[model samples]
Target: MTTSSTQQQTSDAFGYKWARRDSYESPAVRDASRAWLLSRYCGGDAAVLDAWLAGGPKTILDAGCGAGFSALLLFGERLRDHDYVGVDISSAVEVAAQRFAEAEIPARFMRADIATVDLPPASVDLLFSEGVLHHTDNPATTLRHLAGLLRDGGRALFYVYAKKSVVREFTDDHIRQQLMPLSDAEAWAALEPLTKLGIALGALEGTIDVPEDIPLLGIPKGSYPLQRFFYWHVCKAFYRADFSVDEMNHINFDWFRPANCHRQTPEEVRAWCTAAGLEVETLRVEEAGMTVVARRVSAGATYV
Candidate 1:
């Protein structure tokens, strides 16, 4: 498929996903997600995140801000203190605007492609793009463009999916290809069984022992939960007991429906940051993806 069409489809998928705001806006999910975000970006310290937010970043850019969920989760009421701009290519920006309005938060919402969005150079102090870089046509180029909008010494926080084990990678691609032809509603319905399977597997609450590492498939010798072993090595059937079935399905659809879900390695992500003139300060790798906190530095600056 052409890049434009792929982007449009991806945008539509997210638009549909975000429109069902209740699926993600529940208090339980928000609390859990906030904790996860703190762990990733603030070293698991709410105070640290608070201090950083209050540390005089006048203009904040939430690139690819889906329904402004992450921004609300991260900034909360502090959103009123800064010039917050939320940009997205999908219609979800409308939802985001409505949400912020309902919450009495002041923010500028723009429905524009972040990759080529026109913003004054060096105008933003903080750029937050969570799980969004990889969805762009060219992640590296998009990163460079977004980084260019940051002032020197400005910070950027983002996340991108990590390349998984061999079998999991194959399964992910296969599922995505199968869903590509379906309408949004059909694709969402199609994933219910997969979500149910995850629920079933998770209910077992069992464990498995890998006596030997299979380097070819990236399976290491260790003790893993039954569901996680399959989740990490075979196919992604996300299972979190705390999340509802629809929420779980939402997560799966987010993974499978997007035509632009790109996965990257740590080295590649670090290289992209360096090439974009951003010095990597923190790089956290998990089974799912990579979370990064970087600072914009002088062009051609040596990386340590």
Candidate 2:
């Protein structure tokens, strides 16, 4: 596809057709949500929760809550009366509501945009988001909105994309522009060439040994097909998918079919904190991007 067509195609996919948004809500997805919850809150994510627990917050907000998978982290545990609220923009809340109620875990959830959802200012004690912000039209603005919802001295943890991370970003754009415009079945079929190409790239000796190294250009590994392997691996990094003949098909469908996705960097994140009037308490940039804990300066901190 021409670059212009690709751009136009992706924009169309990102278009907020309310019904389409509603339709995408409960599509059969592999259990990435379960693995994601483990890796985030208790695995790598536990560090985030530990920080808040250390800070002794009494309330928490899981912005962009999606299916409320992370809420499972605190199941059956004493929360010091800290209430965790998970919010998402999709009707996935209905399914999540049933699951949580069945599991005997009660959490408050609402359907709203994380960017402008209204809540009591200075009411929340902590905010947590993972791989959620960049999908919005304005991540920085979203940060400002969420930050305003926190109580003084309350902290927020965020994970977002990084600069110079080219592999998936390239393939993501390529698939959305070149591939997502096709019907679901057509898009699924179009992935064959990309799959063959990705297998070929996966065969490269040691090219992918480092997280930052992507044979991104001017090589057999640089083709759109090869990039598909990169996407699969990056995805598997966060999700434990059941390996099946149809697994690649499923990954391709999710990666390409998603109407919108975005990635950001540590520096850009810090800038967003500054621009949003937040004082970052901590920020660690790893190979993927950044893990940040920031607070609104007006909110005073209290450990006691």
Top lDDT model: 1
Per-residue alpha-carbon lDDT of model 2 for 138-203, expressed as tens digits?
Answer: 788889899889877777777776643445456567667776547655765776566555445555
Cα-lDDT of candidate 1: 0.91
Compared with the true structure, what per-residue lDDT tens digits does model 1 show for residues 1-304?
2249899999999999999987887777899988888899888877866655666647999999989998899878888899999999999999999999999999999989999989999999899999999998889999999999998888899999999989999999999999999999999999999999998999986699999999998888999988899888999888889999888898999999999999999999999999998989999999899999999998566533
Worst 10 residues of 2 by lDDT: 236-245
TM-score of each: 0.96, 0.67
Residue 167's C-alpha lDDT in candidate 2?
A: 53
Any residue pairs clashing in model 1, and if so which?
none
CA-lDDT, candidates in order: 0.91, 0.58
- Give candidate 2's TM-score: 0.67
Worst ten in a row by lDDT for model 1? 48-57
